[model samples]
Target: MQDRFLADVLANRHNRAILERWDDLALPDAWLVAGCLFQTVWNLQSGRPPEADIKDYDLFYFDAGDLSEAGERAVQARVDALLGDLGVCIEASNQARVHLWYESYFGHPYAPLHSSRHGIERFLVPSTCVGVRPGEVCAPYGLALLYDGVLGMNPLVPHRDLFERKAASYRARWPWLRMAADAATPHPAA
Candidate 1:
C-alpha cells in the first residue's frame, strides 16, 4: 500500500517536479512533506482530481547549526526561485528550528527535535506525517491511519485544539474524511 501510494505521488506532475527540484537543492535531510503528499492520496481516494484543493508543498530540512530567521529566509528564497514557476505555494522550514518559534506562532510548547523525522512525528495529525525526498518516503507514525481513512491524533504529543481546527478545515474541503473522537472537537473551517 505504501509503495502504491508513493507511486501515485510520483506520478503527480507537480509532486514529481517539486521532488526533482528538492533533490537538486540537496538540502540536508530534505523532504517534500505534509499536505502535498497525503492530500494527493486523499484526492485519489475520494475520486477528486490529483491536485484538487492542495494548498501548498512543504519542504522540510534539518539545519540545527543556523536556526535564525535570516538563514531560513535565504533558504526559502532559493526554494522559491527553484519552484516558483511550478505555480504553487512552496513552504520550506528548518525542522531543527521549529521549536524556537513554534510556541510563539501556535501558542503551544514544542520540544526541540533531533532530526527531520522527529519533526514529522510531531505533526498534529497522524495521516499528515508522511514525507518524500529524492529516493525514499518516510512516515514515522506509519500509514495505517491514511490507508484506513481514519484521522488519528499523534499519541506522542497531541495538540487537540490545533488538530481540531485543522481537521475542521480538512473536513470542510474533503467531507468524506473521518476524525477520531479525540480530535473531533467542533471548529469553524478556516
Candidate 2:
C-alpha cells in the first residue's frame, strides 16, 4: 500500500457520500468552526498493505460570521451525527468540543467544535504568502470551542496592518486578552 493509495481512498466517492448525507441539512459552510473551510479531505494512504483500507479524514472550516451561537451549535450537531454514523470511536467532552479517537480506518483525530466563550484570534501560518514576500504566509490562528458557538480568528477580516493598528490600543486597556499580533483595523467580514 502506498500513501497515494490511502490519500486516494480518503478522496474516494464513499467519503463524499457521507459528507453529502451530512449536508442534507443546512450546515454552515465551514468545518471546525474556524480555520479553513473544508478544503479537501486528507487520506491516510500509507505504503502499508495492512493499513491500506484505513485513511484519515481531515475537514477544515473558518470563521465567516461575526459571532453567532445558533450557527455554531447547528454546525456542531451535523458533524457529530456524521461521525456517529461512521461509527467513529471518538472521545468528546461537553466542557471541551475537542474529539479524538481511533475507530475509523485511519487513526486521525477529529475535532467537533461546539463553541468558544471568549472567541478566538487569527494569525499567519508562516508558510504561505499572498503579497510582496513570496515566502511569507499567514500563521496558524487559534480556535476555541466555548460558548454555544465556535470562536476563532476571522480570516476574511481587514488587512493585517489596519487590524493591528486598531487592535493595539485595546492591549493596554485589556491585559488578559493581549493583542500580540500586528495591529489591524476592526471590521467585520461582510
Instruction: Count clashes in each candidate, considering only residues at least 3 apart in sequence or on different chains.
Output: 0, 29
What is the Cα root-mean-square deviation between model 2 and the actual structure? 16.0
lDDT tens string, model 2, 3-92? 332243335444434445544533333222111111121112122332223223333333444234455466557666766566532221
Point out the worst 10-residue segment of candidate 1 by lDDT: 181-190
lDDT of each: 0.81, 0.30
TM-score of each: 0.91, 0.29
Top TM-score prediction, candidate number: 1
Highest lDDT scorer: 1
Sequence-dependent TM-score of model 2: 0.29
After superposition, candidate 2 runs with Cα above 4 Å error: 1-14, 31-45, 49-58, 61-71, 89-190
Model 2: weakest 10-residue lDDT segment is 125-134
Q: Candidate 1 lDDT, tens digit per residue, 131-169?
A: 888778788767777766667667666677888898888
